[model samples]
Target: MIRPSIPDRSDDPRVDVSLVVNGEKVMRPVSIRMLLSDFLRHELGLTGTHVGCEHGVCGCCTVHIDGKAGRSCLTLAVQANGAEIRTIESVAHQDGALHPIQQAFKECHALQCGFCTPGMVMNILARFEEEEKLDLSDSGIRDMLSGNLCRCTGYINIIAAVRRAAELLGRA
Candidate 1:
């Protein structure tokens, strides 16, 4: 027998929200039940922030919230009111150039299928920023990316890419 899925309750209490996304302030009215991932993808049109597992286990929906890495799927948009959000699309350089991490990912062929690349890159960027003195060790890279699962490339390329990015950033 097949089970039926429950409908999303989108007609709940409405709330006014204002937050910084990709360095720009966005103000709008949203339902309290709206997930931050949906707000970024559907409302803000930032599809780079992917949603792999809606329950936040996959880490594919990772984003920067107030300078820390967080799972947008698990966070409510209303909770992000008055906060700062940074998606994968904003990680590029001011001149529209790829960020060092992104560049390394491309050069090292870190991704296949590309579904999990955005979240991996975003988490790496956030962690790199926080741990300013981080040295990209093999085990360390694996540990850092433990939350993100990629079914392609066997993760060797991803690790190599992160190491290359760290070298470029002078962190390795």
Candidate 2:
């Protein structure tokens, strides 16, 4: 059997991981067992990447890794070495303006308790990146949001927000 490729640290399970987070480079020692979600939340203090269910199925810990959507809860901190990560905190401009997706969500009233919003926004952003544009069709919207889960809003407003973001991005 192949073993994990993580390098061993002398007195602990820590490993060195260097990555770019929200346009800033960061290097930190992370335990082998640490989840990327926990590292983002506890170590880096980027709590915008929320963790609902530890399992990858929930998609609540979604983040952009190397320009693609990934489940931070399912990813190990060591596995993210040398990657570029974008959490919800990065969705806004440095001038404090909302991103198109965030603006759409706000305008469309897509959130209630706001727990699953970050993941939904990140996933939609990644989807726009992957698909280049959205058709805004019902089936297309459903397919785009296949992995994310929301307990409130029933996705009606969310779909509207996705469409509005597509329009704002010139991708509709």
Candidate 3:
């Protein structure tokens, strides 16, 4: 009996990717195997974007892809080509002040280990900014933040922080 050999799938050139990062446009050559989280943290030096699970199960690698929250670990850097990418670092005042969401997180002691805070804050901020009128009910808050996971704080303080942030932003 003869066995078939596996096919070769190499010899592909790297793709040229261009993306607007934190309001600035950048162009770079990237390999097809590069992950968006690795690109942001390694290539761009944006360490604020944390990578918890390489899989999409954990939300620690979440970032705003064109104003919508998504898992960076699962996204290819090539897919982000010609798109606006917003990490946790971008969610701050132009004057270098902390964004209301960040401020609220600090004020409410929403984080302990600080690993999941960035993704949580980014996800919440995206929703808070997109929706003109937000309802800050307990169930609503739980549903909105359902994507983000927090091992510390049991999420009570995080929920309170998001509520306070909504109030501070005048969206509640």
Candidate 4:
């Protein structure tokens, strides 16, 4: 487990947050207004959950909260009390074997700049795990990725990656 490198600020108003993160139990006292993204990145030292639009429109801070994809930047640390949060750090095998979705992203060349990749993977991974069968068609894939925005690519490769990920995960 990666130890948190941030120093605690006791002077700020804080709330006790206890939650399971990437299969590890984390209990911390964080500022009441701290965003879940900030808590994950700063308090717990999970940097995979990126923060892009601070506004939740970019989807760069997506994480699995109680098994559903949610924008971590839009969520408060206190709001996630007792919730199970899964960051992109947990997607791959312990030995560094990439998750199928991550492998698909690489094989399909779905990322450029790689800023939005983690959130994109987390969102797609949730759908892949929850749905029995996903519609891998172009329109369907676009709908699935509607929440995320990528500035580098035209999304042609991203859509293709989603299809490839479906096949790799046996969802197709």
Candidate 5:
């Protein structure tokens, strides 16, 4: 039997939201209470934006919203209307070439389980894009990456990869 759409509760009405995702314009009907994380993962099939802590603590749901990284778990799909959202899927080139950051992560062995890599990379991208002079100092890098949590790798190579990514980005 075909499943019918669930009725929207009064407090959770459906609304249309428009956003440019990964360089493509998209519009979808989403429940007003739908979190951006869910909208991106379920509705749009972009699973790279992982939702770790639904409360936004783990930072696994980070995404670039209008050129800045924001916790998708805390952002509503309706609130993202008319926004430009970038997910980790956009980090790679269309011809299967890994973006420099991705290559750095791979070559440096920055990821283990890889659950947090997407958010981590997006956060790094946000910092690099927003800052005038990229600071890769230990303390500076720690402060920028403090929000993202990874249980593996002990962050040794991740830090190294971030530094390497900075160099790669600088060469561009």
Candidate 6:
């Protein structure tokens, strides 16, 4: 019997990361310098977390780390070890039913080009989940969305979607 040769990667620096992703526990070996966004998208195949601005200025890579919204692009995979990470992929039901936030976005036409939709939804979802009372006023919504930048839709629809989502969540 012939034995297949396996390549050794011991010389390359890597760290074992363990975390709960989309309610499932996962463990993987990632490069020491790998960004959380890259780890999620490339290693875990969760591409919903977009990488827009590598500098983390754009909110295109927002995700829930330990139930708090954070920029995945700015976080290292090793730093997220033992943390709960939720990406946009976890928003919908297993049967493909859209979450209320996604429904609101669709009803209000919050997205154009759809590049920023995932991050926007994740950011808004975190706020809704964490806040006891949210300011639904236009200015208040603007304040909440200050971190995310959307070139399309001019934010008018996005703001409307936030309010609609709140109403759907019974938080309005």
Predicted candidate 1 versus true structure: per-residue lDDT over 68-102, tens digit per residue: 99999999999999999999998998898999999
lDDT: the better of candidates 1 and 3: 1
lDDT of candidate 3 over 1-172, digit per residue (tens): 2423323324655899999999989899887878898889878999999887678766889999998999999999999999999999888888999998999999999999999999999889889878877768888899888888787778888889989998788876
Query: TM-score for each prediction?
Result: 0.92, 0.91, 0.90, 0.93, 0.91, 0.92
Look at candidate 4 and tell me the lDDT of residue 113: 96
lDDT of 1 at 122: 90
lDDT of 2 by residue, 54-133 (tens): 78887889999999999999999999999999999999999999999999999999999998999999999898888855
Q: What is the lDDT of candidate 5?
A: 0.88
- Candidate 4 has its poorest 10 consecutive residues by lDDT at 1-10
Q: How close to the true structure is residue 125 of candidate 5, measured as C-alpha lDDT? A: 85
Which regions of candidate 4 deviate over 4 angstroms?
1-11
Instruction: Name the candidate, 4 or 5, with the larger TM-score value.
Output: 4
lDDT score, candidate 5, position 155 = 89
Instruction: Return whichever of 3 and 6 wins on TM-score.
Output: 6
Q: Model 2, stretches more than 4 Å misplaced?
A: 1-12
Candidate 3 regions off by >4 Å?
A: 1-12
* C-alpha RMSD between model 3 and the true structure: 6.8
* Residue pairs with backbone overlap in model 3: none
CA lDDT of each prediction against the hidden true structure = 0.90, 0.89, 0.87, 0.91, 0.88, 0.91
Better of 2 and 3 by TM-score: 2
How far residue 53's Cα lies from its native spot in candidate 6, in Å, is: 0.4
- Candidate 4 structure quality by residue, lDDT tens digits, 1-172: 2535445656779888999999999999888888899899877778889888789999999999999999999999999999999999999999999999999999999999999999999999999888887888899899999999999999999998888887887777
